[model samples]
Target chain A: MTSEKKIRVLAAKPGLDGHDRGVKVICRALRDAGMEVIYTGLRQTPQQIVKTAVEEDVDVIALSILSGAHNELLPKVAGLLKEQQAEQISLLAGGIIPDSDIPYLKKKGIKEVFGPGTSMNTVIDYIKNYCAR
Target chain B: MDCLCRKISEEKERWVKTTLNKAKCDRRTDENGEDIKVLYTPDDICAIDYLSAIGFPGEYPYTRGVHASMYRGQPWTIRQYSGFATPEETNQRYKYLLKQGQTGLSVAFDLPTQIGYDSDDPMSEGEVGKVGVSVDSLEDMEIIFRDIPLDRMSTSMTINAPAAVLLAMYIAIAKKQGIPSTKLRGTIQNDILKEYTVRGTYIFPPRPSIRLITDIFAFCKDHVPQWNTINVAGYHMREAGCTAVQEIAFSFSNAIAYIEAGIKAGLAVDSFAPRISWIFNTGSRIFEEVAKYRAARRVWAELLKNRFGAKDQRSWMLRYHTQTSGVSLAAQQPENNIVRVAYQALAAVLSGPQSLAACSYDEALALPTEKSVRMSLRTQQIIAHETGVTDTVDPLAGSYYVEYLTNEMAVKINKEIAKIDEMGGAVDAIEKGYIQKEIEERAYIIQKEIDEKKRIVVGVNEYLVDEKVDQALFRVDKKVARQQAAKLKKLKKNRDGQKVQLALEAIRRAAEGNDNMMPLLIEAVNAYATLGEICNTMKCVFGEYRASGWSGR
Candidate 1:
């Protein structure tokens, strides 16, 4: 634990959905997990989120969308990150996304897709495990 | 006082120790963990004044019910609020709902529209018509209300930040339908205060948002006399995981802020107060919710009459719409939600709401399909027609436990409201982040409770399930973006561009001054101005709101 660097996570809401419940809860958990968290508030575009993740040099980039715009918005953000040469940052997605769409989001570079009932422990462990990987 | 009451109270201790010990059932507390006594007798509510505190229905204080007849004269309006995909699709849904015996129209606009964006805007790219109907301009509004006569129907638009723009669009549609503003009967969720405090759909900062809301109040008092100016909301706060007590207190405090703002803006109390209605969430907490509605009515009635000097009885009545709790619906064994919704609806009906929108069973998975939505509506119908629950007025009014809980909730809520008032009111409290923090703390507690399996949420917690979600879910059309964009482009190209520009200029000019912006808003939409155009004009004057000191964020 002493040898591990503090994980910097960029938590962002990448759509017009104002539902900050899930994102805020996750951010609090990440911070409590001894991670440095930078929260970009609601209505951030794909490019803006990716740029923030890059500029902050975050180890993990977490995105939440409840407005059913994940398929269109998630891929755009992931693609922009790769284009911006910030693909090293692990991308994760969460919120009211359907199970069927999880395969597409995963294929598009979202390392993890957390749904409604996913425990905070799972999220923190995922970040640690992903970092280890 | 009575022999049976005394015996019950005396025997309850022995009953708890002997019978209940074998039962091993825990004592029931509220969502906030407040004590709930096993049996409430007259001694429990001895402090309450029946006539003064718990007055008769339709009378002062309105603790029992708002109208004397309650549902006997007229049952609560069955309002199933929904929309998604596109305007045409939404219109088809609206027509279907109306044909299936729904009494009212409640519109749910998409995220982009709710936040005041056109379908073609870059901010609206992927969210064209996902959460609700997308109305880029008057064209969409026209399609939404086509062949549905405005004068004959009552509509409720679930919008907040851009409520003024949407209301104007509705007015324009009514005008085209040959209905005058005075004849239009409905409400606009023109509650920007709740948006700033709880929900985050706001476009302008609090000050200007209040100004816009007050403008609507003044404007509607004169023009749209039949319209409810604002549906002051506690539902969203409750959905955000506030306790029933906090929900009532915080919402009342917000309502107080609006009333004060309206009066300070030079409108008399009676003129606008009658149009003030509320929306509350009826959750799984059956007695607590009924008591919440009851307590809210009494508190509001007294506040209007005493605090604000509202002379009219209509102003004192706390008429509210109810929605069965969305948070209570679980994704696990989604079919279980129907039973949850039925009880919630029953609680709402027992407590008396002006209307209700029961959540569909499949809502926890995705947007409701036609079959699920119909079942939701039928849930309300069964309660209204077959359940025999609506046959009595204030059915639970005189019950010892109900009265005791109502009094308890009212006192607690009023105490909290007093603290907020001492802090200079809701807006100041929100800016200070007190309200948001309170809600966040409660939300965190509830979430943890669920996670730790302390609260048994049926299929979610205690009752485990190994099942697949095989329900055919309603998926939004991906092509809606392109289709709406093309339509918006064609409409912008074809409509009288000069008239639109001129109308937008009028709104910009109105935004610069203290003048009421409602008329200009209506004219702009009527002249084919897009929602974004109107909101942008105001944004130039009242720059878009950026939340600050958000410790949670």
Candidate 2:
């Protein structure tokens, strides 16, 4: 597993939502899965998240939002990544996002959207498999 | 007495070996990780002297209940925390709730408003009216409370960092309605310590944030005598996954800091202690929760009387509001949340809360629809009237198990409070990242337990389902942001700029010194100064708080 570089993932909360329980749990799970995880603390803007992901050269940016602002904030992060020519970094999200909003979020460049009750093992495997591909 | 104790112990031992072993009974524990014996008898609570330790209701060390009559004289207030979209939309919801027989109001402000931002600010983009109602200025406040007389209504605003500004707006609105400040009654979730640790809506650092709270305490003592100054909250921390024990201990530690800050600021303990109230989360563990509340009341009563040497009896009471735990709800089968909330609400009612807010069944996914919220309120009503649980004061007081559990919980809660006190106080512990780390660890453990299927959350880990969610969810209007931003722009342009500027300047001056901030805040709020403008003025003096060290790494 050390032969290849450790999978670097950037976990960010990109709005005024302070619901960090899901994000914190996932961060720990990813780290235990032998992946490097960087958690940008609460109340981060989309631009800041994109900048950190790009500067850190992380392979993925996992966004967690529960305040119902995913429709506006998630797309903006995806857009900012494209604007910065950092579209290589895969984008995924998990929170209270509805199933109906998944298609639109995917179209906006979020590859996957995990809602409430998704296990941490599922999230870690998704990242490992996504990075492998 | 000795012979009876020995006989009970022998009988319990015989039962454990014969009946318990035959049934293959496993060792059990409560949420606080305390071991529980299968059978409890007179020997378990024989050490407790009934007159002193388990006193009568409304007496000193209020372990049984706070009121002597309990729910017989007056039932608990049914207040549901709700709001979303524009002020007009939220006003309709409030009026609807009142018409539906809700006893009190609990306001849920939007994120931007909670964190002291105008709707038009860049930081507020996409978040204007999402989680709660958007209030940018006095105009928005008036519109929200329009035609609802403030003097008669008991409102609770869930605002922390910007609690001073919001309370001032409520006061100004009351004054406009020809009601005196003394006649107003309500509570502001003016707790900032929990904001730094659990709920992240803090604007300033701890020192100045607590200073603002003490200022409110002092001001309300003279002007708004009926107002509860601060609702020191453990509900959020509990929602973040702390045990019921940590919830009581941590909130009391935070409360001690506030009371000390008030006394340091030259206010007598009795003057502000009577106005101090609390909010705790009542979860699915019915027996443990009931015992937790009972233990909490006793600890708080003793803390006020023995530790602080308070002379007033009202100051010794631990009057609290209970909200059924939202974290316990499962999003898999949203309908299952109704039964969960009903059980939690039953636990809270049995524990004797001053008020209660039952989480709606559909809350795990999105904001609750009208139908879902009404069902939640009706859950409380059924417990009050039909269930007959509230028929007697402290109905479960004499049960051997509850009495024993209450005694055990009080010892553990006091031990935890002592640990926090050893770290100087809650403020110091929070600054050192001690409290945050503790809660994060517990949260991770709880999550892992559920993931491993050890914790059986119905419809989540144990009961699997493949049906899609089909409930009619309430959706916040996306256009509410644009409308609020435009309204804020117009209000800024139309108000007297000179008066607003003068009021903000006075706040700046008061914030820099030891002056009470409520009057200046009320003046600024009355002059149409935005919440952000007032908070920003103080921010220039107090600066903003940036959390460090604790990254959940």
Error of 1 at B369 (Å): 0.8
Clashing pairs in 2: none
DockQ of 2: 0.59
Q: What is the lDDT of residue A48 in candidate 2?
A: 89
TM-score of each: 0.96, 0.98
Per-residue lDDT tens digits for candidate 2, residues B296-354, read 99999999999999999999999999999988887898989999999999999999999
Q: How many backbone clashes does candidate 2 have?
A: 0
TM-score of chain A for the candidates in order shown: 0.96, 0.98
Question: Model 2: how far is A86 from its true place, Å?
Answer: 1.4
lDDT to native, each model: 0.87, 0.92
TM-score for model 1? Answer: 0.96
Question: How good is the docking of model 1, as DockQ?
Answer: 0.51
Native-structure RMSD, model 2: 1.2
Q: Which stretches of candidate 1 lie over 4 Å from their true place?
A: A1-3, B1-27, B548-553
